[model samples]
Target: MGPARVAGRRVGQFPDGSESASIYMNSGTCYDLMKNPTKAIEVYNEGISKYPTVSLLYFNKAITLFNSGNVEEAMTTTESAIRYNPYHASSHNILALSTANSNKVYSLLAGLYFLAAEPLGKRASGRLKVVEELIGSNVKKDGEKKVNISMPAGDKIANKPNDFSSVELMMSMSAALSYSDSYKDETNIEQMKRNLGSIFGVLSETTAAKGGKKAGDKKAGFGWEFYAPFFADLQKKDFLDTYCHIIYASSEDDANTQWIKDNSCLKKLTTLLK
Candidate 1:
């Protein structure tokens, strides 16, 4: 949502600047909307050249490459985005969708990444279910350990020559104070507790689950809250605010905006947050 719209923007102190801050912010979006991925990539390269720390440029460029059928390039660029900011939801989505389940770690983390994206997150629950089914069915039917999932047409994560692993990404998330550094909020602790529960809850499904811990187990492995603190503030937003943030990518105070609240899945998630 718009809440993260300004994510990659930073003030240019004249001496260290490349393009104007606003230009970097809008250029890629304009190019993409105009259906010119080449231009978007060019713009993103310019932005990254000057502001290498801006994760959004990498994210934008990754998506542009993905759209242009440059799957391998997209995967690499997505990793760069995540390296710059482990919580870049867009980059996570691109990687999850692009990376095939041939890589077990990304397969698992892809679902987690979708879930972690929160309201403004990637709507990838269906993909998770698909991955789950593929994983589950193959292990039961045959002795095959590598599960190749069938992706929806035009929605594949990536194709050809991909060995990107999420090992380092996991370490970055598990480290303490990562999210707190950005999210300074009151409900951070409570939010972390719930999120860790959900993460372990899902991970417990696989035999590869660390320490063989259950979803809600306290010792599911490492100190999850220590590494994943962004979940805290992500869960504290009101339903409508969450809705607006995700749908519009903006935090324009939508508490009073009336809308249907009949999504069954939304109900379950709300209960978890409460």
Candidate 2:
């Protein structure tokens, strides 16, 4: 059975189940997993309204909001959840993801730095640079106390952080810059290669130290597979071709020969090129 139905069954067995916020939160989770975010939000909202003091309910609602693409609302809801319960890990994780997806890249990176720094410190630099370059400002000044990066946009648009999708975008941009023939201008190519080499070198060393394969080394042996679709969609032919070569070279997969035939994304990309 689904999460909501299971939660409902569990609640039905309890004498005070009708008044339990956790049951509602669980129901919402089931709905979310079913891709019914609106229903999930409604259920979470009801739970919060019924049990105003239940911090977890607020967290659930905030996550629902985020999944529904109402990131700013999600941010506020998460703050309320934290205010009610400071020790909520899911709340922190959701907040991190929400913030990362909301275009508040700088703030999100800072939060990630604080949350994952101990275990992830060595690899954080490249991710941190992604935030700085995308946001055009450093939260950490050379000789000043670290400051909260402010979003000049109104709160509605500024509160959320960059999400996993944003990270994928960064990877795509990096791949494009690394392989684009536009950089074939002798001077430009050399500079682009150097920058890409440095970035990938750092990433490789860091992942290696952690005993993980380098970034983008998936089982399919396609580096930046997720990012490849974006570059293809954008009609970045040179980058696309180079990316395909890299993946095929790395994997020696004959399937790579029929990449456009195999991947719907690449097929759409071919249309874009035409």
Candidate 3:
């Protein structure tokens, strides 16, 4: 979906000003899902202003900031989200992802290993592996087994320095590191490397074992992280044309704005955001 359609769909006319919060919040979600983080941020700010106590507004804003690579602002916004709703799962998840990318090892580990363990990290590991396989790696040898590697103790690895010349190698290594069972250890750089290599080895084995092809190995498919490109592809293939027609017919309106307002998806999303 394009930004204009998304914006129009979610910003339906509400009779009461009190409903403006709902409208803005829903608009923010549509913008975020469409990969327009700046628009999402703006709508979320408007939502928060209309309903100061709505924790989901802040949480969604934080997510948009994080996805936009505004780590500092995202962190601050996450703190506010937690302050408003301490038990919000999506807030914690976004905070965790942001912390992981920012090199906040302790907090990131806590988020991934403890708070968001069951729902986030394990699923993320699977997704990471899928991406690795798509990038032409075999993943069968890894087989979900935890690998142990011995290494010297230090803040940095002095023993087997990385050769960062190859972008493909670096990307593969980064993806592999996400599946390492002990990524939480700040002092185990060598162990991290070894575990990553193990993952790589597993990918190689899986590829060879399968005689060179695996299911869904064509391209990077749809996921939350790459929603924009996916949405663009859908538009290119005229999928949105059918969707818009259905939405319009159901609501008796040419615009999807009214249909989205009557739908309950955004309500569920609000709970998730909180």
Best by the TM-score measure: 1
Q: Please, what's the RMSD in Å of model 3? A: 19.4
- Cα lDDT of model 1 by residue, 45-124, tens digit: 87788888888888878888888988878877877777677655566667766655344335445444444355432354
| Segments in model 2 whose C-alpha atoms lie over 4 Å from true places | 1-3, 9-19, 100-274
Per-residue lDDT of model 2, residues 1-274, tens digit only: 7677787667557655365677888888998988888878877876777788889888888877887889878876876785586455456556556666444432343333223221123333344344334433312233333333323334433212212232333433444443345654634224433343333333333331123433344421121222223332332333433332222222334554455345554444335423
Best by lDDT: 2
Return the lDDT, model 1, position 76: 74
Quote model 3's TM-score: 0.40
Rank candidates by TM-score, best first: 1, 2, 3
Error of 1 at 271 (Å): 19
Ranking 1 against 3 by TM-score, winner = 1
Question: By summed lDDT, which 10 consecutive residues of candidate 1 come out lowest?
Answer: 157-166
RMSD of each: 14.4, 15.9, 19.4
Cα error, residue 108 of model 3, in Å, equals 3.5
Candidate numbers sorted by lDDT from highest down = 2, 1, 3
Report every candidate's CA lDDT.
0.47, 0.48, 0.45
